[model samples]
Target: MTDTSEMDRRAELSEFLRNRRARLKPEQAGIQPFGGRRRVPGLRREELAYLAGMSVDYYIRLEQGKVRNVSEPILEALTRALSLSEDERAYLRNLVKPSHRRPVSRPKVLPGLLRLLDMAEGVPAYVVGHRADVLAWNGLASAVFTDFAALSPRDRNWARMIFLNRSVQAVFADWTSKGRDTVAYLRVQAASHPGDAELAALVGELSVKSDHFRTWWAAHHVRDHARGRKRFIHPLVGEMTLDFECLRPADGGDQTLVVYTAEAGAASERALRLLANWGADAATGAEAGEPEVGRL
Candidate 1:
């Protein structure tokens, strides 16, 4: 198989292992806990198989994606056996469908939009398509999290940053919720763009690299975060809780601009002002053209 196809397989295997392992509890499995013999927190493979009423061999094969044609009832059994969340159960079903896909296009980044993003200055602004691919982000956006322009193309994945990058992980103080939202957004995106090869690849890569990604992906949670409160710990800005908004075009169904800003008179707003001054000074030093600067 090619690299792209391999990514899909990897994602499938990765997510399966995570979900299967998350459902186990000695008490839940009706086993008496020997004071110190329980090394694993979740259920073992055989235990899970027994609960699902499937042969251990069959379950293992399914988990491995060696058996691809799983029925809905079987999936439901796995969901119940593993105690999967409603979102995860939905995700398991999505993974089996042929139409579910990711992006594979060379992104067409717009100069005007980049300029607008730059203009946002202190306020973080960036655009992502249906697949949650960061098409463009301003310097402040980069300052708050990533500098997309400076990063290698292969490494510009949002999910990877959440699960793989230390800096990104540190930004979200609410890790579990952060994880939930990430899956929710992607689940929604995957549904919106079922044939996007690039997105599929991103999902695939995450599934291969992180078991958490795998489990979450399988759960198939869906959400649209048009407006919400998000907290971030910027190395320069310190702790900040910003309100976020999603702007979508009337003509384009998938494109959205995400803007982050602190509420008026809030401590985070004050911190943002301080960070802005620092950012201006740094921008001056770089001889980089200035983007727009504004208050929250």
Candidate 2:
């Protein structure tokens, strides 16, 4: 089964090229008024190839999965011709980087570290790792995110929440792009830590269970999710666009601390205050791993 590595590579090459082609259009590239009966949105194979100053045959071969190895110069030409976004361009380069997919190992979080999640005051905070495991979160985070506390340790997958959770699906205003980024980020994580068995299992589950994840993963996209504006439609709080920052400790390349905050005086701020009050008033039950007030 794994012997189909070459096929996989070729399929990725074919798929990305097709997607890029489908995304571009004839009129945008300044083609004259010969626009009747066009079957696609973006530039066609030969047309795009011609615009990139490459032979139509060569581009056709790439698109048809006939070309195995592509040079950097030609790749750059294709990148520009396709008008790739920063993320798309980076993903393109990563796919060509000769390496196998690996999983990042999950780290052991000391109790103190997990407790830090609860110290963010008004801001929502949570800790995740390379595999998108929910390492830890404070009450505000639990309030901001869907019932994260309810998920089994093994079932806590950010990607899964994005797709499976109806609440999470409604969270991102631009759900499609957010969904794509989640998949792409997983691809990058899978690549960097191929040895992580847990990550492998996660990918396996997603690839088999979700056709949408399967489609995106096969495209071989990669992304570095450092910071961004996240729109969350919390069940308790209507819609909140929060500025999120990912903090990686000096000793922590794999572990990421994601904190969320709203612009001062925004409706999101009011929603978060309401969430915090709900969280404070809501009895905090002791989880399996964490220490308790009486026990130790």
lDDT for model 1, on a 0 to 1 scale? Answer: 0.67
- Mark the regions of model 2 whose C-alpha exceeds 4 Å error after superposition: 31-41, 64-69, 108-119, 167-181, 187-226, 231-239, 248-254, 280-296
Per-prediction TM-score to the true structure, in the order listed: 0.60, 0.71
On TM-score, the leading prediction is 2
lDDT of each: 0.67, 0.71
Location of the lowest summed lDDT over 10 successive residues in candidate 2: 287-296
Error of 1 at 118 (Å): 4.6
Best by lDDT: 2
Q: In model 1, what lDDT does residue 145 have?
A: 74
Query: Please, what are the lDDT tens digits per residue for candidate 2 over residues 1-115?
Result: 4344455545666777788778777677766524467777678777887778999888888787776567888878988888876766755664555455443344565455456
Model 2 pairs whose backbones collide:
24-42, 25-42, 102-193, 102-194, 103-193, 103-194, 104-193
Q: What is the C-alpha lDDT profile of model 1 across 115-231, one tens digit per residue?
A: 555567678778776666666665566667755555554565567678887777888868778877887888756644556667777888889988898887677455667789887
